[model samples]
Target: MAPFTPFFSEGLYQNMRRVCSESEESIHYCSFPQVEGERNERIEQSVARMMTIIDLARNIRERHNKPLKSPLREMIVVHPDVNFLDDIAGKLKEYVLEELNVRSLIPCNDALKYASLRAEPEFSVLGKRLGKSMGVVAKEVKAMSQIDILEFEKAGEVTIASHCLKLSDIKVVREFKCPDGLTDKEVDAAGDGDVLVILDLRLDESLYEAGVAREVVNRIQKLRKKTGLEPTDAVEVYFESLDEDKSISQQVMNSQELYIRDAIGSPLLSSTLMPPHAVILGEESFHDISKLSFTIYLARPALVFKSDAILLLYGGNTKSVHGLETYLLSRDHSNLKSEFQLGDGKITVDAIEGFPARNVVLGEHVFLTVGDSVLRTKGL
Candidate 1:
């Protein structure tokens, strides 16, 4: 499958490029400390820096194949601290009216905090009231002071853009087994050729950042090749906490570990293992699976794989097939009939009427008593 291409807006991309091309002197001069103490010096330095950044931005736009057509609606001057608010304001007014072609230079204490606040409906309403009190247009002033504007520009749109990499085109099969003194060779054989062996490395959430995930993928690929296997069929192992004493339950723990390992190892999958794929949903991650499922479907995957028990179904989609036995195995037989609604179609029950749901093991096919009759269904 082709690697996922990230999407970015043209305006955001151009703004970022301009910020990156700004000079170090200009950045340092406009930074909060240099402009804080002396009012006249701060204004002079800020205006000079703004002019330099704007000029570089224009040059980049003219040279690039794609250029920004629309001028910026506003320029927001962000200060690191509010101690020099008055000085910052004066500098902003001069720059907005003189240097940059923007209509205003709205001074914000923290740009990022402002952006986040503006995102809230309550803040939006309060902003209107505050704008009215100050005799300024509320919608015209948007905040983003907390973020280092220069750094944001340097990183480009990729930094803030959604980091979702749709892997619907990749195909994979999952094999489950309890660790039962199985040798590495036997496990490798079960993989049926080259396979990614994901070891559940139980790590704290803080350690699973993008950089760490990339590192893990690279390390796993090396391990796979060391065993004399192709890179695509490389074995990827992750450590996940299987013990119930840990916060995560066994099923949830297994699912999350598998998902993370699979995503990291996706780029290295062989053709045989590649299929349309979907992201694994961790517990307490997203609210609804239906939306996630829709996103996966839009990527054009034929089937969706999820370890969660709850399935969200929407109208005008392909009818889903469920095995009577499979459902019973994952859940207790008693809980099964109560957990799901039966359609008009005939279902085979595989357990006795009062059979406790927890005792039902996976892969059992039996008749279950529901209402006045017995129905048969497949188990997990």
Candidate 2:
């Protein structure tokens, strides 16, 4: 809430400078952005409180270097009144959750448990009212108990040292208590009156591990962009890890495969190997090789494995296309007596009569059947 300011006239130069202010906020009662609509004080106050929560959450993320791309596990909101909590954790829940990127929201009424709430008389506002007794009033205001403060908040007034005081005569200050096993740096807190927003800055391994899939999607989209692929263009996504088998990239691929596919509007291929006759659009590596390293390739959908009437490699895992079988097969391509090469192992048809064209394997004599056309891998 902002206090209204009355207009005052200074010298000619000062008045001219005020009229030529660069920011509207610098001038009082500037209403250019205001729409001609009915104003509801209740709704307006609700929005103001909601925005305060959001602002504090954002400040925590920025100051602590927690990027919005990464998600957190939980947020603890504490206030004295349950109705106030309901207004936030109920009416305006979705907006806060999305903005904070927290998986869960917990509300508590014990503000005194997490913070020390006290009142400090506004010396400027009090000096006009009490004149000589302002100093005595200030000490009693600081020494006021939590119960006394909460009670005074409702009526917006209290009496200290036989002098009646109003809420405007003082300001409520909240000093949050830091949790055990955590330093002040690890916790961030800000309040609008009694509304206390506490954010734990520790990173959640599970949430971040899941977030890796989002990073993969971002990279794949970048690769798609580098190759000048259009939004409607359907391509295949391939992930190859330079590290261990159960690598971060592989885990994200396995866990968030569906998310990756849906985000880029493409299918994630099972096999990391390069396919024949496929136009290699582009390949990108994670910029931070020290922490995470993986290769992502974007290419035009070059081939499909349709053996036993099922999809192959990594394509089998995706269930978006119905009526298509999905399987991962092991093979031994030993003892093919004839030498053959057609469409660079994408196709091979012998000179024999009345023989259907079958897909061939290059390294091993493996043939993939795709209805009338066969994408063959030649045994090398």
Candidate 3:
């Protein structure tokens, strides 16, 4: 990163220095980074296979008009041995499940239910040896059944149409059987050369509503980007929907509150009310999920004065007070941009119940209890 920092951005280099607390201004002064351990070939191969599954699954979802926010029922994998998919699932299941938003992965050695393997001659390989007879052998291989293919896979050879065929002389291809109601018109199939992946396109009510929740998360994530919020800058999120979308939005908030909160990095401020300073998205931003539409609002938390003494009160009561800092700037500083601080206790908060709350704040997070109401600047 240091080598390319100068080419990328000077601000990035400055940020790296500030964040890493590097005394040296230039990273050219630091030692080059290096790998620390021996590479595990098995794990590397597994990860590659995992990536292939995710890529294929995503493509399947997109092609079938299935939105990424909505998760599907399952991923159907067809391989000669179930262990092929099971082995990959053992380590990388979470990556596939989360990335594809699928509920489960089902590995099958039996492809008869939804698919079957079709054997074909490796034309160039078998051509030289079989000569003119290759045409007849290719036809016979195409007509072979699932049982024949399974047996041939084990023995690596079998006599087909009274002609001897070896594993090296043929190629195996898995063809979809097309479940009921689904036509064989479109393949709806993807592969990574070794295994076949078919996504279950069947969607239920629960999954659709869950997708609505994810859509809400997606919107807030967009808002965070639109507002230029830092990754670690936790902003309170709010949402409001029209008369028709109100129930849907509330359902999303009620059911998927945890999911939305974790995704947005903030507790939902309110699902019913939109704040005065709330920035609302127009029709352009609403990528409606199942005819449901909603607007998300974002407000970066504000700490009135210094956040040090949130327990401070101006209600003429004696209480515990710390090094509370307040700024009294010039009358020209109405915009609160560039000012000189003159603390005369001008700002006051009379009604706020204090409680401890440790939050992830700033680039390098520090755990501290800043009162909740104090953070919203409710009284101010």
- Number of the top candidate by lDDT? 2
Candidate 1: residue 155 Cα off by (Å): 28
> What TM-score do all the candidates reach, one by one?
0.17, 0.66, 0.64
Candidate 3 lDDT over 1-380, as tens digits, reads 88966767656666777767635676556567798999988677667777777888888877777878887877877766545567766767777788889898877767567676777788888888788787888898888887888889888899866778887777877766677777533336776435678887777777877787777777777777877777786556666675563766677667776776667665565644432323343212464556776556665443323233233332222232222222211112332222112222132322223422222122112111122432344442
By TM-score: ranked, best first:
2, 3, 1
Worst 10 residues of 1 by lDDT: 293-302
lDDT of each residue in 131-194, candidate 2, tens digit only: 8898899999999898888788777788898988887887877778888778866676767665
Q: Which stretches of candidate 2 lie over 4 Å from their true place?
A: 1-38, 183-187, 192-194, 244-246, 270-274, 307-380
Total residue pair clashes for candidate 2: 15
Query: In lDDT terms, how accurate is model 3?
Result: 0.61
Report lDDT (CA) for all predictions.
0.32, 0.64, 0.61
- What's the alpha carbon RMSD for model 2? 14.0
lDDT of 1: 0.32
Cα RMSD of all models vs. native, in order, equals: 28.4, 14.0, 10.4
Q: Could you give me the TM-score of model 1 versus the true structure?
A: 0.17
Per-residue lDDT of candidate 1, residues 264-327 (tens digit):
4422221222232322221112112211211110111112123222122212122221432344
Name the regions of candidate 3 deviating beyond 4 angstroms: 1-49, 159-164, 180-194, 271-287, 302-380
TM-score of 3: 0.64
The better candidate by TM-score, 1 or 3, is 3
